[model samples]
Target: MPVHRSGSGTTRRSRLAALGTLLAALSLLLTLPGAATAADSPTAAAKKPARGSATMGMGVIAHDGRGGLPGGTLVAQTEGVDVSSHQGNVNWATLWNSGVRWAYTKATEGTYYTNPYFAQQYNGSYNVGMIRGAYHFATPDTTSGATQANYFVDHGGGWSKDGKTLPGVLDIEWNPYGAQCYGKTQAGMVSWIRDFVNTYKARTGRDAVIYTATSWWTTCTGNNAGFGTTNPLWVARYDTTVGTLPAGWGYYTMWQYTSSGPYVGDHNHFNGALDRVQALANG
Candidate 1:
């Protein structure tokens, strides 16, 4: 009886010690920073963008939590559009007929993916008498900004003194395939962008336009205003108004106001009139 009682006591003590350890672990876990919330979780999965697949405004239109009014209609500026591989060979004549005076076509992404339809879209838009530029869908995670910029320059992203070609654009926004901001800290993102911009200016003799959403700019770059003086801002907002711009930008050079055009791609507006579009192209 004595031995049995001793065994029972030992078993109870062992359970109590285990329980104490579990409680201590639970306490530590509760106190730890960055416990996963739904907000921190990867976005409810959509069709993740494949390599060479991401286009202009893909992330902003897909995962930008802010809801833009559906079937949105607002008109009052110089009309424009952006295209990529997704649009295939765009009907530039049709877009021209619809009054789109300026356009941007996706040129390269990271250092690997160049838009297969680039030649058609880039040349087609310019041939149709539209002021067109090429944009790089930046993948800072895949390569350094300078490497991607070099790839972009070698591809269709190069600028010329021609009156029809606008400077290239850097489309930096949410990551469709992974974490927001491509997992970079604000300082790191700013550095990556700096490398691309400096390299692009060296190669092309023009500062690249920066395309982004205000929400993305705040979250990724901590609303860094450093680029405002150098890069033209192509602010994307699919609402009735352009809404608030990111810090440092006194005005948006272009506004991607909606993706609900009657034709193929998203519609945009130059901040000024048709002559102003020519001015940008001239520079």
Candidate 2:
């Protein structure tokens, strides 16, 4: 069942004492590269994609009193999904009925491919009362991040203040071409990401949401800890646990826990309350 705006417990006591210890440990883990713990490390099991119907949903609260989240643990969260051209002609009304409160859609890919259905998908999401966002499939090897960001913005990746739009996303995961890091060195990859996000922020007045896997980030960017403070981290892990986050982020804002869910595209969770998600959309 989808936890709605009022579902989060209002009377939950503060966990400041426990949070302090966890933050200290996390701070240490993020500083050093390849320092993730064994359990948090992406396991073979983590690679399996999620399987379920639109009726099934998972949230940021993957572990409820059973384990930890990116920032120790959160008291509450909500479930959502992301779509692309791959999921053609989404029934937004049906998705909303299936417990999705928000969604992100692919708007552009590699400065060349704009999602042919972006107009409908992006508008359809909002028409159904779902918070909608736009993301770009990055191709850092073909062109610079700034150039790609501009292309994304020029297409359909821009944001609005209607309180229904989430920040633009930079999807920098597996390389469809050959080189996973887009033929760039680790430092070059980091610089590329900086250029993209910096340009995104300058254009939209908000930092871009970073969608990436832990291993990819580690291998490509040396698990750089720079973006966590500035941008929201959208971590991708397919298993039951989130495992380790990228170096810079203390907690993840979104988790793509499964590529296969009740939805057509990826299943996700917004790791905060409805109002918090609204705030994210508001910005």
Candidate 3:
């Protein structure tokens, strides 16, 4: 844009005054409390996801809530719940009394975050006589799956065959923090997941459970079916039915039925009875 510059005194003075006023306004904006600066710009803010701030099934309700309430018979299904730092310290007694027989707590996210409330949520569930496990929120963009798995294990994603501790879960769903598939292609996503689950198994001598929503799985791995054999599936669908699962899994080991389920956190159901939950824990 070309500006017409005049040699006339009045025009020059007017231009100088206008420039001074603009600078003063900018200075005022900078001094204002809570004002947005370059560092707080929307574009700058979107680049970084808070480390260690995610939980299990974080994206399910938002992405796949179209399932429309849980449907079918829950008769023999075991009741469970999954919690994260968002739930803070859980009241396990309330959950247990509500017939929640199993539970999972967020253990770690990528290699950067470990749940601060892990001990309380994990141990409290066990002490209350509920079979419990831990889950790792996968951030495939930040680190290799193996590194994350080790971090998860080091933090809290360990297993014990005490008939009370279920295997850790790998939460590889919609990336709430960044790219939909962590900016990876379907094949790349699969390999990353493979690395994480493999490393988790190698470190703990137990297969890691994989938690995901069907839509994300389909979009991310093109609905890859390779993991159904070794890892147990924990499918999330916030509706009346469990709905369609990802390509590889024949059955879901656990179903996260509703984020609005009774009691605390997101409620879930083991595919079978209490003994089945115990069996997974024992393994």
Top of the candidates by TM-score: 3
**Candidate 3 error regions (>4 Å):** 1-49, 66-68
- Residue pairs with colliding backbones in model 3 are 68-239, 68-240, 69-239, 69-240, 70-239, 70-240, 71-240, 71-241, 225-248
Residue-wise C-alpha lDDT for candidate 2, range 198-233, written one tens digit per residue: 998889998899988787889889999988888998
The clash number for model 3 is 9
Whole-model Cα lDDT per candidate?
Answer: 0.88, 0.78, 0.87
CA deviation > 4 Å runs, candidate 1: 1-47, 65-76
Query: Which rank order by TM-score, best down to worst?
Result: 3, 1, 2
- Please write out the lDDT profile of model 3 over residues 1-283, one tens digit for every residue: 1344444766889999999999999999889999887666767446555667766766775566535556666778988999999999999999888889889999888777788888999999999999989998899999999999999999989988788999999998888777889999999999999999899999999999999988999999998889889999999888778889888799899998778777778888899988888889888
Q: Judge candidate 1 at residue 233 and give its lDDT.
A: 96
Clashing pairs in model 1, backbone N/Cα/C closer than 3 A = none
Backbone clashes (count) for model 1 = 0
Query: Can you tell me which runs of candidate 2 are displaced by over 4 Å?
Result: 1-75
Question: Candidates 1 and 2: which is better by TM-score?
Answer: 1
